[model samples]
Target: MRNRMFAVVALACILVGCGGCSTQGVARQFADELGEVALSAPPTGATYYLQVDNARVIEDAAGDVDMPYCYDLPAWSEDGAETSVVFRTARKLRDGAYLRFDAALLRGMISWEEVGYDELPDAVREVM
Candidate 1:
């Protein structure tokens, strides 16, 4: 019984330590998700201001930037259509940069499965 319990506990730890759900780890998370993103590691020292806008990618002077930065589905997006939304950041990030989202501000928005550099859902602004 003890051996079995130890095995389970070890497995759980392994899973949690290896990036389960929370997208916190700066370098590893960015590497898996946005490899083509041109940015440095996310800003470490300064607290950032975040609110959901149409599409805005914030940049830092010390060589960090963040996100494919998408928001606000197009008017034509709908239930069963392929929708692509694009937004441009004011500045570009250097290599190894990353964008971080405001978890608190993004409340009720950003589905777990839908978070990616992919097509936006066609749901209307009200629906989003």
Candidate 2:
């Protein structure tokens, strides 16, 4: 009985440890889903945004630049069709301002481009 209980506990522990349901895991899964949708030919288009709300901002693991946190999710058309994959950063900038990005350059296909701060959205500016 003792051996059986130990085995059961060990198995449970292993299963719990193996469960990949952490926030980071969820984010990675989301990124993966976006990648799949991006690869597929969507009719309207797909936008992938990594959002960090409020004062908390996720730093780019590859570099020192802060992530373009946004309140919106990556926009993709419901109907699968060929369209542009636009990447944007809507993050709060220094001095009570926000840095934004444009949809001119299609990104997130092969790599992400570093865009300069454009301007804060009207609503965001108003709030600040």
Candidate 3:
């Protein structure tokens, strides 16, 4: 009975592991959003409003670590018809990366998420 249970659990683990990396298909989602916000049907290249600064490094048990980094990504539409915003950051450089904000990604400031992540108290959300 125990052998049978172990085999079943092992098979489940193997199947789960086959899903591979976590951040796949990200480009496709971005591409779809670009189509909506572009005049050229897919945004012929982009001018990113990204600014990299002094990111922190944190290490934990099991030797797993996180490089603390955060970014504020906003966009101005062609012809200036509409403006959209997003706030992104990493609590960890790996799988924990995420897009988190509230109330439509406000004017690059006044976000509780930005003030608290990545061991940074005063990032000042760079908008390029």
Candidate 4:
């Protein structure tokens, strides 16, 4: 009986832990859904691609800490739509590096990650 209980608990834990997994398929689906919406309208959410360029450093005067690097950059959507977005990071991003951003109108940039040049869509690659 104890062995069976342990097995069931282990299975439940594994299932719960995997719930937060973010796969490429999930990101693609999210981008696809958001792509259908017009960019002029209030952004629900969407994926954006951009190449790193200049950044503005925001200093924290309270103490010597990691200052956030901010970028107001031109971005492209999955379908090659264009827009501007502002995002921040603790460290300076490498010049010419490509990134994928999950963003909303009100929220600005929700999350972002560096990606290889090949991951960029054809439209973005042409301009970047």
Candidate 5:
């Protein structure tokens, strides 16, 4: 009887511990919003730009790592002229070597506008 009781307790502990392994509520919401914006059809003739800051993984970085990285995804509409910017998830580089698709900077995005490359943060003048 003691052995059976121990087994049941162990199972309960394991289940409780597993809860912490799941994604946080905020992270989940960020992902859902990003996916909705990214997967949605682009406005007619509009271009989609992903403006991402460095993931900030390093304590002290130098050179290009400090600059803002932006990637221009294909247009959702061929006739659209609108431009949209979406911040990338922290630590996810624009053209980094890794293949991560689960991170985004913000839970929401702003409207389309003509934002100059130089006007971007970190003096980012280059776009990928």
Candidate 6:
């Protein structure tokens, strides 16, 4: 009878331990999935406004491929934050064209798209 009780208790303990491990594994899986979703989502970073100017055409070309045009322009945020951004484009941007820039601290400029003058914030419009 004693041996039987000991065996039952040991089995219960083992099962309890396994249950804890299973819970931990589930939590870990959830965390991993959340991290992946965060990484895959688009960057929610600062947006800056600027106007396209003359591009510094890249002279080096590989084979017959068209060289990229580089632009180093001053950018401003809605709150009047100022910064300089340098980026390359496959083709030249129209001079005096306004653009919205998505930027991250570590990644610099993430992307840019042309926007109408009216779309710019009042602070950005005032300066430009």
lDDT of 3 by residue, 19-116 (tens): 46432454335433332222322323322212223243223333323423333333332222223333333453333322222232112322333222
Error (Å) of candidate 5 at residue 49 is 7.4
lDDT of 6 by residue, 19-107 (tens): 98796676445334222222222357677888887754343346224635656677787776666666666777888999997775435
Q: Over 4 Å off in model 1, which ranges?
A: 20-128
Q: State in Å the error of residue 86, model 6.
A: 0.3
Greater-TM-score candidate between 4 and 5? 4
Clashing pairs in model 3, backbone N/Cα/C closer than 3 A: none
The residue-by-residue lDDT of candidate 4 on 20-105, one tens digit each, is: 68544554454443332223325677787888885443334343355355556777888787776655567778888888978774
lDDT of 3 at 122: 28
Candidate 2 lDDT for residue 50: 27
Off by over 4 Å in 4: 1-43, 55-67
Q: How many residue pairs clash in each candidate?
A: 7, 3, 0, 0, 8, 0
Candidate with top TM-score is 6
Who is ahead in lDDT, 3 or 6?
6
Q: For residues 1-128, could you state the per-residue lDDT of candidate 2 as single tens digits?
A: 99999999999998788775574675445445333334443344333222223354333435324545322233222232223232234444343223232222212343333323243233333333
lDDT of 6: 0.67
Model 6's number of clashes is 0
Candidate 5 lDDT, 1-128, residue by residue in tens: 99999999999999789767764664455445343443343333222433333443233234245533333232222223233334332343543231212222352343343344443333122333
The lDDT for every candidate, in the order shown, is 0.32, 0.38, 0.34, 0.67, 0.39, 0.67
- The TM-score of predicted model 6 comes to 0.58
Q: Which ten residues in a row have the lowest lDDT in candidate 3?
A: 98-107
Clashes of 2: 3
Per-model TM-score versus the true fold: 0.21, 0.23, 0.21, 0.57, 0.24, 0.58
